[model samples]
Target: MNARLLILLPASLITAPALAQGGDSPLDPLFTCRDIADDGARLACLDAAVDALRSETESGEVVAVDREQIEAAEEATYGLTIPQFRLPGLSLPGGGEDAELAELESASASPQRVIVRDTNGQIESIEGLAVAEISENRSGDTIVRLANGQVWRQTDDTYVQLTRSRADTDYTATISNGALGSHFMRLDNGGRRFRVERVE
Candidate 1:
């Protein structure tokens, strides 16, 4: 994994909850490193407490805000931030290759396909497509293309055939099942449309 990805790993491992805290809330638990009779015992106790709290929060048995408060209490007592617990080797299932393959297969099987014709002389396919760009005509109909290569005249959510672009040329297209309840594009590009069900 990239070093930058490591930065997000810690944040993702630890949940951050927005909880209301004021004088009215109950006092937080404190773990004192100095309280132990010996140096080794004190360090071990502190480590154990922090690990236990982190595990509970990550498992959703305890919320993140409560954990934060606990850490705050420990910090106040010890004047040091406890080492946060993280699951080792956490990763997305199947990685990017599997995800791309799934997307292509879904698009190929979709009923609605959007085709694209680029200036180049190569052809590409897009499946599981959604609206990327819209150029308006005088008739108020929109020329919509997908991440895949299916193009159609869309009046509203429904699309109708206007003109088909030649496939021998370089272009990109996309198709989508639109089977998901809600519609959202990919976070990175905001163009690749994937159903929540398909993605999950």
Candidate 2:
């Protein structure tokens, strides 16, 4: 284990800057130790790399996020336009002028409720979201709060009524990306569809 760790130093030193600038990954150094030929040198390298990584993490220069955290972030930011930028220690798949970091496929237990992304890796649709609460604004616009804490507001004048007495599970919806950056929410119970914009 020590030898394997030592091999990491030179590779990490060589790769860390490229990773920082090119949107690769600092975590690559953790995997580079296997290439070292000398045992003592490999152990030293790994030790140095590990120390650097620990320091970077403690100083907030690097952040570690698991799959669930990333998915939660994706869900929270869905239906919104996020400007492209690189974050340290968060390298995403794909490359090119128009390529985007592909989101990890959702591991939600609900078989039918999964986040779907478009060709550009933008969220295209989310299915089977339970309605947690519903209300109306002073302007008579309907406001819906989903179980995941997302808030959506009705944008059109269409009059539609949802049964308030039904269980929250009975008020499921599927929201999809609509034409020209618009969004539409379709209720599974009544098949009622309406234009909506995220309010929170």
Candidate 3:
């Protein structure tokens, strides 16, 4: 929200596509508001940028997502291992119970075993079918595209066992957190495991 960031918004938007492939983009709103000598002018510039983005979102030129959408994306991409989606309702590793999440129903060591039902709680295991597209990346990793329109990319460099897939066959992906914030993904019954990340 700083003035410097606001001034760079225009140029940053022009190069957004470059950021999609893991490249960095400076799309912060502060680009436009920066470099204004007067505090009032800088504030006005920031407000204008916010209003313009809001208008664009309303007009369908751009998408504006809320917390729920973010939660859904994390769920769809990485399973229930998201730390923020479910607040601190978990028991400490050594013992004593901490403050439970306001809406958390239960927390389990196995992410899939965990259950959260509050307004913001993580949903049950993400299970789906209809594997529409199954391809390998340049690194020889499987790229799965579900019929429901979710695209996942294999982050590890492991060759998939099956080269062909049937549309009617059911496929499931399990994602869990490793040490630190690292996330791992598994496909099918777990023959090939990869550090998968969501592409769409």
Candidate 4:
């Protein structure tokens, strides 16, 4: 953005001069573009004068009169208060989805663990369990290991044992739990041996 263009846009938009009442020029109207060398030169001079006036108007030395405030003050002086014109509520036509999402994410609480029952009628104890490592296998199966040397794999509603040994030594094994909630042991049984269940 050009600096001159920015100044020009604001200057042109301002219908009434801030300091001068009724948009009156400080210089007399008689001393216009016609008084210059030629039409083009005269126009240029007029533009320069306008720019100078705008600059002067912007300076803090001049006290700019706000017409609205002036009128309100006058009304109060006369003991007749006029209701000021108010702009209606401004709203974006379309909803701000991104902004709303950002606000929701900011205000949202972090993930929390609630005590839930397991498939084997056992209360899945997550007490003092700080998640150490979480991984997903090639079969889209999620495995969770806690800080308390407890390893759990997503079996069904319950997290079943991926391995019996939880001595902090990582060992991969094949374990099975049926849809009937039956626990079985299968070593090197491949993927088909274990009956997979939804781990909601």
Candidate 5:
């Protein structure tokens, strides 16, 4: 840590209890050591803090997930409503990645599928997902299982003409967010569209 960082630490370090409640960083104590005037005492505080952090991490109390892992998790649980939790030291994308992300604002076709985003920068839709399986429930509602193991069931009464003649890449699906937290799944063949909710 440099002198400038030490000088700015106190203003940003929140209370430990508040940080725990928010699932925020557990490095508050380390930053608090910035207030120590004696060099030896400050070093001791930092060493203790680091040891405590390591112990917590080893015990699984504190998790450390990188940006790529988080992004992959986000993609996996894209349409599902899950609890929001963040690990400490998780950083936002850098300026270089930001420039690449800016280019993704518009949907572009490439070898890899492009994720479309809305004006607010939220993921608008995910396309080119192969339909792994299609089944109907007792109520005759359409249930779709994608290659990624995401299971979605039809919520509305709209009848979706989906066939299992050719599974996998033969039928592609696009899932996009709709108004009022709703999601719509559209199929490539016949452009069949239906409202769906992720069941698993």
Candidate 6:
């Protein structure tokens, strides 16, 4: 899969002149709040900062997600070569640090039918071994830690009870996108499917 830059920084920060309390730029909120000696005043300053942050989010000037949402989204998108909003870098697949560097066979090919290959040759898919370690939270969500150092947590309310299939079983995580641009990761042979979000 090809990586695309999906930046969501506030456009005002990028294009507007520095904000000012007067003609000169005002102190940055984080920096200014740190200098407040009075506890109440410091808290009020911090509140203002939080209000600014919320306004940025509400105005669609910044892309923001809570920790829970992010954790869910991450688990669902593991193994997919997702676009990042950070720096300019190589287009890489979504996986843990132990992920193998695989290349897309053809960049000009069709979208969903992406073919990935390692140094050896073409690969079936991004593969991971289901380790003995697993857990289910009170919310009915699950987290699966693979042997390859990748941790996949089940997002949403979907529940997939695991089976002791094998002592050392390898699982396939296939990423497929819908026409509406939604992506789904399916664990092949794992009885149930989850709206998983990759957190690792």
For TM-score, the strongest prediction is: 5
Model 1 lDDT tens row, 49-122? 67766775476544323332333222111111122222222222222233332333343333454333235411
Stretches of model 5 off by over 4 angstroms after superposition: 1-23, 35-37, 81-113, 116-123, 161-168, 190-192
- Candidate 3 local lDDT, 8-78, one digit each (tens): 11222322121122232223555757777899999998888788777754554443333433343343334
Candidate 5 to truth, TM: 0.64
Ranking by TM-score: 5, 2, 3, 6, 1, 4
* TM-score for each of the candidates: 0.24, 0.61, 0.37, 0.22, 0.64, 0.33
Worst 10 residues of 2 by lDDT: 95-104
Q: Please identify which of the two predictions, 2 or 4, would achieve the higher lDDT against the true structure.
A: 2
Q: Write the per-residue lDDT of candidate 6 for residues 6-117, one digit (tens) a residue.
A: 3334423321121111132222675789899999999999989878867865665554323332222233233444522111122213322222221121112212333343
Q: Which stretches in model 1 have alpha-carbon errors above 4 Å?
A: 1-4, 7-38, 61-145, 148-200
Which of the predicted structures, 1 or 2, would earn the higher lDDT when compared with the native?
Answer: 2
- Residues 1-200, candidate 4, lDDT per residue (tens digit)? 43221121122223212212234445543277658778788888888877776675565222333433233222111111221221112121222233322322221121232323366433322122234455667766666443333344554433334444543223233333344444322222132333332221
lDDT over C-alpha atoms for residue 132 of model 5: 67
RMSD in Å for all candidates: 16.6, 9.9, 15.7, 26.1, 10.4, 16.8
Clash totals for all candidate models: 26, 8, 15, 0, 0, 9
Whichever of 2 and 3 has more lDDT, that candidate is 2
Give the Cα-based TM-score of candidate 1 against the true structure.
0.24
